[model samples]
Target: MDNAPNRTLLDLQALEDILQQGAVRTLFQPIYDISKQSILGFEALSRGISGTSLEFPERLFCIASEQGKLSELELLCREKAIARFVEQDLPGKLFINVSPNTLLDPSHPKGETLHLVEKYGLSANRVVIEVTEQDKVDDGFLLLKTIEHYRQLGFSIAIDDLGAGYSGLKQWSELRPDFVKVDRYFIDYCDQSIVKKEFLKSIIELAKVTKTSVIAEGIERLEELTLLEKLGIVHAQGFLLAKPARQPPRALEASQVTQLNLRSQSNHNEMSMSVGCLAQIEDAIGQSTRCKDAHKRFEQNKSLMSLAVINAKQQPVGLLHRDQLTEVFAAPYGHALYAKKSVVELMDKQPLVVDENAKLDVVSQQITEQEFDIRRHIIVTRDLKYLGLAPLRDILKHITEEKIRHAQHANPLTMLPGNVAINEAIEQRLRRQNTFSLAYVDLNHFKQFNDLYGYASGDSVIKLLADVTVQVCDQSSCFVGHIGGDDFMVVFDGDDAERLCHQIINQFELQSKAFFTSEHVEAGGYWATNREGQKQFVPLLTLSIGLVRPDLESCNNSHQVAALATDAKKEAKRYRNSYLFVCNRRKPAAPIVRIKTTVHECSV
Candidate 1:
């Protein structure tokens, strides 16, 4: 017992040594609620300060508990944690790590812990004690009693890292904790790994049934964060939210919240077919015919009153304002002469024009960085083909709305832009006829595999597919989108088409091996399978792609090019088992693509 450094001093001596000499100090790591996209809390991690570097408090706590000094160690960590959380004025929850053995002690010093909470002006409610799922914890009766005791005292309880190697599914049955934290190992590659995503997603479903709050830890990228949000995760603590510091973080800003809203609202509105190019955005601006409403809108807003007028063709031709019109009337150049002169003489043809397809952030950055003319409203277009004017105030308001909605409404898997983004992308591609590739990807026998392993495992598989697709395509030239579930589409060009598809599938299979049972991985490192009784080897995950490039010789307009690409993509789907090519060239319609052998013979 005396051999454990933590228990060497015994009782009062150990407590005094920990406080006066400061044997333990707590460092915080930010934990985010994946659904909310806001910093929900910080996980208080304990570290033993040696002469120089800090030691893992887990080792220290484990050794102490083994030596019968868990009570002493837990008390020391709790005291310091409360002091720091209070001093920092952290607005969100303070999550402190606890050894399960410590909490299982019926005679643990709850009285001292209560006194410390009162001393620091913190409610027992705001603190969540996180016990690691990495350890073997089977003390059901004691855990229950301890939880009941904490519940009465207003303290929340959480089971940390519940889907990792040493997970305890039985804790949910026994302890009924208020929160369940999905571990980082499950979340780290969630954006791309279907197996890991399903695994974590099942945990989320379980949390929902238990009515427990779920938070995903270790989010580092926008795609990973988006996937978690879509999977219905609510509380996240991660580096993207902010690194833990000595002070509390400011709540997510209004602008941030607005961005979230715009994304969410867009998703729901985007799925149905849009009438024409930029029709949705045009509807969003609430303008029917251009000039009728402009007269009324200009009258209502007196400050910076001006309107740009154009014919039905949207050719910029006139500028009008109450002030400008009044000046023209009073001038020696009478109303007849002023009105007779073309309005184009006054209107700035060189007006600052913004591409309508750009994100809100891009527009905001442009406004901030560029020198401006007197116009407060900037003309925007889809790919610089004029759509409408974005008033400065409207842009600010829209940005603010975007943050609020996007923070709470992001998707958790297949972070390739969601349904709303899918619509915008398709519209853009169809309008431009830029000869990009639209390759639809779906997993083979994924559902059966998921059913066999359970939903958590299924989600992991889905996330893996998304990750592979994103990695395989070039972010600069290719546009990848998730049309919900495991179905995904990648837009690319002719140059590296087949090679890129094969590369993505190959990488996905390689990454997915670890998640599969050894029996699933056949000899020669091949993860072979039976697809409808056929001996199919997904050693390089089987991906079906349809490629369409503009047939410059056959098509006169961009619309025909888009239709050709669409038709080619459909043909590609018919021969969907492997890497296949379908080009929209000028040749007479040939025999349809069938097996990989037939398609390969023609394309090669």
Candidate 2:
């Protein structure tokens, strides 16, 4: 207690020394662009000197504000950040956090940031001025004017800690910053909180309306990051991606990149049948090509309906329809009149250009909304560069074929994929030599339940099982298929197969009670006549899940996998209650006999 005052004096002196000597340590945290799977930029964070009272940024900034050196401290920090950023040759823009009060401070030096960046030979365009929203703005107009000044100087503006401050939405609307960082509170456990997920959705929708990019910060878990990606949030910043460091990672770790790609591929497989499948590599003509030359090429290729017109950057700019050109040539003295004119003069500039990865159904809807002619061709692009052309007929044909195939392969009762699709899924994984676990699920005593309770009640129980399985399996990378009757199959891509199996069994056990009567519930089962016409007490409906991790090196086809799963299911059915049988033998024995298995009984 006697040395408290002296310690305070020493801390104040340290703050003063830091401000004067500019001893701030600048660290950078990477902001990831999910779509590009690369670092979008780095947010420059300032830390106090090591082994000091203000080692963390929060205390350091608070002390600076209390000592009336906020503006000076911020300027010095920005200078250090800019110098270090340039020294390290970091990629993408540098995001520097500046408090609104600091920008509004009368003592704040105008054009000092621009001068510092210029001094370091860095472009102001590559620097993002993050307007920290923690400080209350008494004068909104002044802050807006200051932000506009930064914008005029070619500095992109961003609102930091949105939803954690007052007047955040107002600042977003008034200043219209180029980016907005969502507060970490909302990102925490977003996967488990519906309110947080909805809030994020609203923010993303509003950002789309304002044309501002949203960056989710403080993502400390992969689940949170995965949910953000699913919500179409393009940019994310968090420790899960890369923590702040003097030398931050310029690119995502290879494993993280693979996960991102796999998630993207899995999502595409689940949601979208990409239009790229229907795109044909058609020849494209340059914008400067003569109309006569285009006509000759069209005539040379008799089947060509239209030619995509591209710019020097290989981006689709327009389309030249054969019918339109033919009509012009058939006109009186039209060919002679327009012989030397460039195709750009007559090309349709508003032709629909769709990304190669666009969903087939979405593309179909776009075609319908545009009222495109059936013979018209649409330009397809990959990353904004022209890749091929997709005819309207081909898109429609593919959609029709897909609908038919889906109907044929989908089970009529639950609409889940049937055996054929399940076999194909297993075979595809086997061909890729990917290690995955296959869970074969069946209902024990299902036949007795169907007889005791009517077939209608039985169908309801089957659907209930399907719903529970799908709900649990949808949380991870797994494929759920209805293998006729009460039997189901699941192919999980990761090692969490046993956990997922338990979840499915637990959920089904809880939900299946609803299908039983009061007496049946009390007794845990009902009396039923066996197939031999003998009375017996039937146990309650329970699940038997057989989980097997197939060895890709030895598992040859889906048939062998099916045999293993079937044997494992037999082992699980030995228990009368909900149970899981994990097969220890990865490879099946000769003649596909029963293999060694471990039984895990699930408590109701």
Candidate 3:
């Protein structure tokens, strides 16, 4: 039993010696940007010295803490990792694990790591200090101060293993890290677990509110990846993505991309339709017309089921039905009783009237609300003037068709027009010979967030963005379409394309910041593993919009507009922040004029 104490001392001595010699090895794991299907960065994981019982990372850290040498050991780990990171000529940020206790060690000077970065010809901007979340942070003030000091020197902070340790939310709120790595617990079975899905969604919501970004750790299944992609998480890491390696890879495996794309296509094909377009209008009859005259018209037009009875000003007053008229006239001596009476005497006063522009689904709901008074033929009007009648059967049929069309042509997630609808809408605009602007919208770093969160959460972000787009654009003058994930198209009649795009980008910037975690806002970016499994810093999500003016005479179709606007979008994305690029490709013979305007630059 006395020998046990001596053995403990020997183990402590070994740990101290290892720390002094800086014998730890660093292995990197890649974090992927799911949307781009590319690597974002790599996390540097520390391993114990070779041929030692402390060879395992968890054991090495635990033993070091037990030996009261955690501060020294962690420092050594950081130094060695940074040195190797520089030695290998890595292309991304280096995520170095840091305990709050290590930063509290007054013996270690502040900015020591910053100086080390300079020694290796690297800037502090390339280093992301991953704060361990397992430990309780008692001295919150001290922790915040230390992190703030590091921030001043350009070192981004990440809260690691969120939802696994004590004070996770507290630490996040206080420190406001650049990245919050969701613990693997919530990610497990998130695809099937409604509870876990809700929890992840809340975390992502919290991050968005704080303007921080999340990193989903330990993703292993294709189902998980598929779910996360739908949730709109852009940053992810797991064995499925890439195991920790000595060098990072540049892109996702081609096979993985192909598989994911096929799955996406399959999922898209499964979407069902809802609602439909406006019903066709039928004619109205004059209220002053005699019953005999109206009866003659109904007899002449066998298909005329009902007609709107209108007043002198062409406003509908009542509905005259052929069946009701026939029933009253068919009665014994009915012609002698009503042959000279006006059509108003027999017309139904309470008729179901709706505007011509109302959606078929909304109109159906209105009709359903009035269970007793469903007009056999609904009266349709333009500007309160009688236009036509839409039969009940036709309305029902249109709604069903609309639902089917929505499923086939609208974005499954946003329920907005997809490529098929967008193409058709653009062609119609061109066919009308109307001057309009076509804006192509894209979300920057959206892939990174989608990789970090699950698809369920990522989808909320996309939906929110869609909502904002729909809200800002006038439905009367503008048509919005979801051009697949994180990309949209808006067609605007009149010269308000620039104004509308600015509003969209501006409104999106305000709403999008809330989607990120606090830490991401503080550092102006998020940390992820690049292709070679090296940590890289990706900027927060921003919008890049490209606008092009459509010429009725010169442009052949919507494809030409998309092609021209794509050039502008590329130029807009080249800037460090959100920007708008306008291309005047109206004249076929004239040179294209690109307008580079800084309408709204999201403060990074």
Best by lDDT: 2
Q: Judged by lDDT relative to the true structure, which candidate is superior, 1 or 2?
A: 2
Alpha-carbon lDDT of model 1 = 0.59
lDDT of 1 by residue, 65-91 (tens): 656777877787788888987787665
lDDT measured at residue 226 in model 2 versus the true structure, 0 to 100: 81
TM-score of 3: 0.47
Model 2: per-residue lDDT, tens digit, 337-408? Answer: 887898866787557777788888778876875578998988888866789998899899988886677679
Error of 3 at 209 (Å): 37
TM-score quality measure for candidate 1: 0.41
lDDT of every model, 2 decimals:
0.59, 0.85, 0.75
* lDDT, residue 541, candidate 3: 77
Model 1 lowest lDDT segment of ten: 262-271
Candidate 2 has its poorest 10 consecutive residues by lDDT at: 262-271
TM-score for candidate 2, please give it. 0.59
Q: What residue runs in model 3 are displaced by over 4 Å at the alpha carbon?
A: 1-293, 296-302, 307-316, 350-375, 379-389, 474-476, 587-604
User: Model 2 RMSD to the real structure?
Assistant: 11.7
